[model samples]
Target: MDIDKIRNSAGSMKIADLKEGDQITGMVTVGEDLYMIANNSVHQIKLADSIDPKRIDPTVPNLQQKIFGKGSDSILVSRTMIFAHEICKGDVFEDSFNKEKIMNISIDLLRCVIDMDECFNIIKLYNKDAMSSVDDRRSVDLSMKLPSLGEKAINGETFFRKLSMSYLLILRTFWAAHNKEVDKIFDRTLDFVSKNYRDDERFIKFIQQLVEFSRMFKDWRNLIEHPKRGEYFKIIDYTYAGNNKISRPMFEVVSKKYPQEPVDLEVNMEKLIDLTISNYESLLCFLCERKLKEIAGYTFKVMEIPLKMRRYPHVRYGIALPTTKGPAPLG
Candidate 1:
């Protein structure tokens, strides 16, 4: 395989027909061994080895050294939980921390991505057509599959809560990255962005749009979390009347901001996931464009394994630094 040719390409491509000294980028799993491809060289690692020095065999020619880099600089990668997007992960602009607050910014982003993934999977699994339709007046009893209508409603509410929390986490962590004081409340972050970044119209507008886009979701989650009032989440299956009135399966809730709203579990949650991802990418681009200029010249690479045949420990993604000499063919 011409590994270098597909480095810049998008999506997962089938990787095969690799010779002993093939120049490859990204990690490839063949049989039981893990191939760490970096800087035009392939380092084959045994499945049984615990990353010991003796277990790393430099498959490239004349490179008998270990597979680790000597650089002291740590690279931060903001990657999608799944390998769906191009330019999976790259460096971020931030400083070292002495006083601790929340988790690492990377882990926070990682959880956000993971929460998106969980919501996506739930939507995929539970997005089934209603078993039967009910009359407008008669009450109908229900008995369905393992994940019944009640379970589906619970799943939807849980997903909205998780996604809303993720949205707030992104805002808080992004704010904490720039300032010394950490703001835990969502309202505080919004106030800070509006007050501090008033001069930067572009930044303020983007943040405002994101907040407005996700406001419905946050309000819905609030009802679920704090049900001290009379608000309750309701689920409705397929319903049809004689005069051509129909309503499909939906999660219904009375919004504190607006009137009673019925949200489609499949459609609305997926839209939220897509928007969250786009919002994060836009924020990352804004930060890099505004703060870090010198780190722009560096080329970036990610370690990817095919999602179809994914293994344990979830080898997320890693950065590859260039070496002094080009990789030689294995003799």
Candidate 2:
């Protein structure tokens, strides 16, 4: 594989190869174990300890030359959690922290809502075609297999799962931004909320709710991302006309706060989706509002999501430059 060529040309790509017999071999030798694609999709082959370290980064510092850094696993990252539209308000701006991190998270929360809406639209087909009439001759309540809708449902699940996971990631990012710490997300988030936003009990509860939701779904998010065999159960709704069985992956989530009833998620995807969306929107709105208020002496403007405007609606903000006449818009 031309790794540098692929990295320079494309971010990622999907490969569609033959079904039965396809072999992939490479002459590139390395020191570490290599995991490569082969013919079988169900099984995998690992060539371990078969390469020389000269093929990899082999810079070794002595024991006394440690410095501050410990170790690093060079991983390929595809996308960031958030990217906010950068805008300058004044010459004095935050040089340390990512200035627009909170707003980027807010935008991602909006994305969560938008993606949930799309997922719901896709899943609606299952309910819509659950009963179909056949040319005025016969009417069947359901079919043994609805390939198209099932496929669409699976795609919808993929979208919902990813977008929801992104929201969870940003939820943790908000904690990192607030608490100035990177580990123990739930604890750090709760500490930040208690120390900073505890003046309003309602707001504190809402923040806590958002944190708890993300923490609960952390493992569930992983399960959805990398699904494994025999890790889930199939749920058959006999109440329906046909034997409609939805093979939902089951995973246990350990919650530090709520430890009462472990509700089965086999039939509660919609409810979980709704909860995630609600928590995301609520928490992001609160954070965005706080961020707006944090700005000083900069009478800027921002268009909130529930915005009603004519064509080309935008958030216009500016920093007034010092001028002889008065104050002018800064470049």
Candidate 3:
């Protein structure tokens, strides 16, 4: 019997083929009364004296027991056996393992990126050391003191201008971290602006606005990292500057431009924490993808050491299981 044919036919044999008296060379089906021959033949196999006795010493652990044992040695040995069995069965273990590892890494990277982005945003809105901080604080403070809608409107415009700067900074930082060709892109953008719109006041104004926004975002990030004592309160005040000026059109414009509403100091702080977590998750996804790509290129290196080398059954089985179990059942 050809070994390859027997291996391929192991799963498709009949119970009659596995009875006592038949000669077989392939794997025995556990709990199934079936026997497969090396040449893909089905036959009943007798229990001959030549067959090794299925003896078990109480002290000597079985494969399952050894794999789940307290000692690492036993566990490792069991894992190796399982892995070898899986390979013999034609399982694509290496590819599957690498795919999972890469996914995890990419998720982590994305989370980090998002965290950094939100951190920069929060700092820009509140921190005094951020670019446009002086103008933002002045506008907010002035708006708070005014009773008329018109005065508040004027203040809101200034505040919105400041908020736009924060958005610019966020975009800049995100590009810096993720875009390898950002420098070239920036150079091209500047050249395009100079050649086509340099003489246009609106175009120049747009460029200036974008620059300020980016600067504000970056400055805010710096202040958060190196904060001084009254800094937090000051930042909060600036963020909620037009809270009471809801009737003013300028305030509406600011709200539209930077939709982040500051809650009570404590509540707003919690929101920041939530934003941080959200950002972290986003960055993790990016990182996980990046890592997966890297892993894909080094698949052989990552899975080079065969599971058999470690001799651990649990390791092999665990690797076969899904990384995360599905959601729990509802009551």
What TM-score does each of the candidates earn? 0.52, 0.44, 0.22
Deviation (Å) of 10 in candidate 1: 34
Each candidate's lDDT (Cα)? 0.48, 0.40, 0.31
Lowest lDDT 10-residue stretch of candidate 1: 69-78
- 1-331 per-residue lDDT for model 2 (tens digits): 5433332353322223324444432111112222222232211122211222232422321111111110111000001111122222233343433444544453345445445545655555454554341122224643443223434545444554654566566665565344354677677777877887867899878767777666545544554555455342122221223344433222243333332233323335566555654454445434433544333665433323211321112222223334455444433
| Candidate 3: tens digits of C-alpha lDDT, residues 153-243 | 2322233233333243323333323332344433444454467555566644554544444444444443334544433212223333444
Give the top-scoring candidate (TM-score).
1
Best by lDDT: 1
Candidate 1, 1-331: lDDT as tens digits: 5433333245442323344445444553433445454432235455323333343433322222223321011111123222211222233334532112223343455455555556556656654433332233334454222224555556666776777776776665455456455544556657877888788988988877666645666776777777646675555554443354454456777765733577555676677676776676566445433443234575433333344423222333232333354211111
lDDT assessment of candidate 1? 0.48
State model 2's lDDT: 0.40
Preferred candidate (TM-score higher): 1 or 3 = 1
Q: Is candidate 1 or 3 superior in lDDT?
A: 1
